[model samples]
Target: MLCAICRRDARGFGFAPHLIRVAAPTVKLCSMRCMDIAARLKGMINPNKHEAAALDAASQAGGVYVELLSRTDLTTWSEQEWGRLVDVIVTEYQDTLRRAYADDPPI
Candidate 1:
């Protein structure tokens, strides 16, 4: 396997075992430094996935739960409708952040 960071040959690997022996798979790493670099690389490669993961982490940390309700079709909406939709989304975002960080003001 290639190093996720420098794209060279991997020197080591990381792993997490499942309930069964065959279910366990390895996570390859070129070095301990590359292990950290791999995670960072993953976040950069797919930010939406990382954002979901971060929100899940925030929930675990006692923050407000995050849920993606639905994907909207903005192109079909009229200008006024689009503005309304934007307002709703921005308001929801503010509410979620406020709940997530009650100690902070209007995050």
Candidate 2:
């Protein structure tokens, strides 16, 4: 295995399995140092707990859309179904924005 961060021979590859099997399935690093560096490189090279939780929550909230879109004939949805899905998504989005700007002056 090669270090994903440095492309060097991955000395850290051995520990990768027990460390974070899910997140870095294919990523192999020469050492723990490279993994640490990856988390610092930003762009969620390794998302923190808060970031991961937020993402998970967002996905959960979008479950309706994902479920519907996964169908081969999503266009067959009834008007009410589409309306309900869009309404849920819009409400979730608005709530997120509301939380984001909670400390700012009211609109």
Candidate 3:
């Protein structure tokens, strides 16, 4: 696999344990620096207050990611950061759906 941003081979000797270096294209983040930058930029519109309310609403559906996506504040984020936030939220929604519907029926 290649790092999404850097487009470099991600199979270095110590890459396996980290697991992030080889993330699939859809999940590819290149580096924690990229992920953190994405998160910080997108944090503006993705305020923690809004995330908490959404988590509460999703709890009834037995979502597992209620803990991860939950935010508190987005102090200095920019509007341009909404793009990454949307990406993360969409992925989280799919993961939550799978967990909610696993084993039993949809909630």
Candidate 4:
């Protein structure tokens, strides 16, 4: 199975919230790196303490897009960069929903 966070092969590492009785669900990842990243995404880790370099590397390795959506240092980015980030996020969300419902019957 693909890593739920980065779309890479699971390679035997994975997480299942249900195993711990959490409502969030499960995810498979290729390495400990992705497990940490997924934890950060789920707010289980402090993003500030963990540098962005790791995330950037993981994103690049998995062909996943990265964006600084909630970064407090937004002033460092140009307006065009912000616009592009928004576009990427919106496009990704739409694509996910499309794929999710692709096989569902019409209402």
Best by TM-score: 4
Off by over 4 Å in 1: 1-73, 103-107
lDDT of 4 by residue, 54-86 (tens): 344334433343333445466876788667765
lDDT of 1 by residue, 5-97 (tens): 333477866433342343434456566654654443342323233334434544443322112323245565567765655555444543453
The 10 consecutive residues of candidate 2 with the worst lDDT sum are: 98-107
Taking every candidate in turn, the Cα RMSD to the unseen true structure, in Å, is 13.5, 12.9, 15.3, 14.4
Clashing residue pairs in candidate 3 (N, C-alpha, C atoms within 3 angstroms): 48-71, 48-72
lDDT of 2 by residue, 80-102 (tens): 77777666655564455335333
In model 4, which runs have C-alpha deviations exceeding 4 angstroms? 42-107
User: Of models 1 and 3, which has the larger lDDT?
Assistant: 1
Q: Name the weakest run of 10 consecutive residues (lDDT summed) in model 4.
A: 43-52
**Any idea what lDDT model 3 has?**
0.38
Candidate 3 lDDT, 1-107, residue by residue in tens = 65322233433311231234433223234556434432433322222333444455445333333334354245543554444565455545444533433333311
Clashes of each: 2, 2, 2, 0
Candidate 2 residue 99 C-alpha distance from true site, Å: 1.1
* lDDT by candidate, in order shown: 0.43, 0.51, 0.38, 0.51
